[model samples]
Target: MANKTAPLTDTEIRQAKAKEKEYNLGDGKGLLLRIKPNGSKLWLFNYQRPYTKKRAVLSVGSYPEVSLKQARQTRLKYRELLANDVDPKDYKQEQEAQAKEALTNTFEHVANLWLESKRDTITSGHFQQVKRSLEKDLFPSLGKKPISTLKATSFITLLRSIEAKGSLETVKRLSQRINNIMNYAVNYGLIEVNPAQAIGEVFKKPKKKHYPTLKPEQLPDLMKALNTASIQLQTRCLIEWQLHTITRPSEASGTKWSEIDFKQKTWTIPAERMKSRIEHIIPLSEQALALLDIMKSINGNRQHVFSSRINPKKPMNSATANVALKRMGFRGVLVSHGLRALASTTLNEQGFNSDVIEACLAHIDKNEVRKAYNRSTYLEQRIKVMTWWSEHIESTSQNHLLTTKKSRLKVVT
Candidate 1:
């Protein structure tokens, strides 16, 4: 038989609590109220897990805050969740824990921790580069979202936007940083999986082959135009070194005073900071060395070799070289990146061994013999090659000599 239903009232509720020892009121459907021997009233919901007879007691809020109406609402909500194949009480607890944790586990919070942890291990300039990439590329889109809610598709969109702008390599590196950041989050138990790991499936990477190289005879005109343009000195030097050293602009921009050995005429790029994650020894030509000397007067006390004109503490923006070239009326004619290809093609045409040229470029030693002996980066040959190219640049820049019309016509042909 069902218990008689009674309209809930403040007085009746109070009396019900006071007289609970004598008579317990049951809500007639697994809900019941208990008045403890100590006279405390607790609202309890009794239910069975769907398809199982295991009964469970769900603690509803205590008396006043969860008045009879609020308690009834909670009970109904839980029943609704159960009817929909969800465990309401378990989900409720899970959500509460997630909310409490989200207060402490924000994207910035995790990213800061990740950056700080890597600061000492990574070079100062590389530290700044990663920070910049995140600020420019990742943060605007996903920085505020909870790390837990970052889905693979969301990260794919971020990388795709960068690729659309013609920065495919940047997309790969950014994906790695994102993966690393999420891995850090995972280490701290903030997230279970790295959403950035799914980038291979979501994004299309252009097949890797050699980048296009510029010819030797074209170098003189290119160098002359870049130097005579009204670009800043730092931008000029960065482009010049990018050509002479055959290093990535990131590597060139991030160079430090400590890495250069003026006496030995070598620049040792450390493993942690190198894109290859292996220490790279670059042989500096007199021309590249001279450029560094000029920068010293400007950036001697600063930590970075190519300090920003506006902010000495940070390195020159990675795009400054390319941007300056574009503004100098060389749009599409050259890029900072084209310098690497320029050196490779010029050196190869000049009869230098391909392995030596590759080594000079600080490329990973994929050749078994070269990789085995670590006899890559033959400094003497590189110095000679770079010096020869440097002389060619200085002579051509000084004399404003254009390639002969015959050569230009041949190029067009």
Candidate 2:
């Protein structure tokens, strides 16, 4: 019959004394307390490697710091790992290495890599906006966190903090952006599951809003307001340019002289300045060319077609048209962006093709192949569409001006 080894107790451990040489007191099953001649007691777990069957020692902890009960728990865990064909010493080393790697591969580290990947794909203006959000909103909160170790709750807490500040719009965007970064990590195999995938669903939804716009019949009122409004010529030209070109405020305001082609009668907007991140070719009408001639006399030498009043070297303020619209009694009634809707309504009412009108506005398409196809496919038709819209504006202003003058003539009698 085999004899069983007795487990060491706290009383025996406390009484263990250092001798001339280091000695061990066994607590059975390969766990022992080593009392060194320097008067320190250390806990060691000696075991045989599972596959190799070689002897190995795992440092459980120091004695007084790790109580007998705690050391026993660790021994049980290590024995379970060994039973499952894992070497305790090797497993410990692997766990330590993973912990170290997690600390180095922080949230900010992975996010920056993901952000850099999107740089060339999106516009420079959009890239900077994304980078600023990372630094200002996301980074200061969870930037230093190890992405692999982060749970869904960690992000939920962040969203709640952002929501508490009453910036629901910011909260909504950051939640999606954070999830996108996590998705980037998942695709790269940095982590297994995306912990932030469901966090956005837990937050309050923001209200949907639309840009202020006008109906088709109200076109003459807008034209009359622009004609007599006490605004700068540059501002009026900017408003007219955007309306004529069917462009966004930023796209029209940031137009460079190099983008114009007098012979071709086209305005080629680069992909970097466009919201869709796709290069757009706008067919210019006679009215559009006339407006350009006026701008040429005012700012032909300057870099931008509509240069800033304060700094001619820079583009005009993007908000200048919106301000002008408000000043022309279109406040809350129509905005700068609403100019696109106004033109779209008038064109659609005039029986223009819907796809060609959308293409003129540079609306993003869900199908990548079709989007590329439509750009060239609709260019010829778009020329007539733009010309019609431009002439609509020109003739509307003339009719309104004649009416206003005739009314004044009758009042004089």
Score each candidate by Cα lDDT.
0.74, 0.87
- Model 2 residue 339 distance off true place after TM-score fit, in angstroms: 1.3
Q: Residue by residue across 11-89, what tens digits does model 1's lDDT show?
A: 6667864553534456645556666766677777888877665788888866766687777887888888788877767
- Candidate 2: the clashing residue pairs are none
The TM-score measured for candidate 1 stands at 0.61
Candidate 1 Cα misplacement greater than 4 A, ranges: 1-41, 45-58, 62-99, 111-146, 149-213, 226-238, 250-259, 269-279, 289-320, 366-372, 375-377, 391-413
lDDT of 2: 0.87
Q: Write the per-residue lDDT of candidate 2 for residues 147-215, one digit (tens) a residue.
A: 998888888887798899888888889988889999999998879999898787888888976789989
**Candidate 2 ranges beyond 4 A from true positions:** 1-5, 161-168, 309-313, 398-413
- Candidate 1's displacement at residue 313, Å, is 7.2
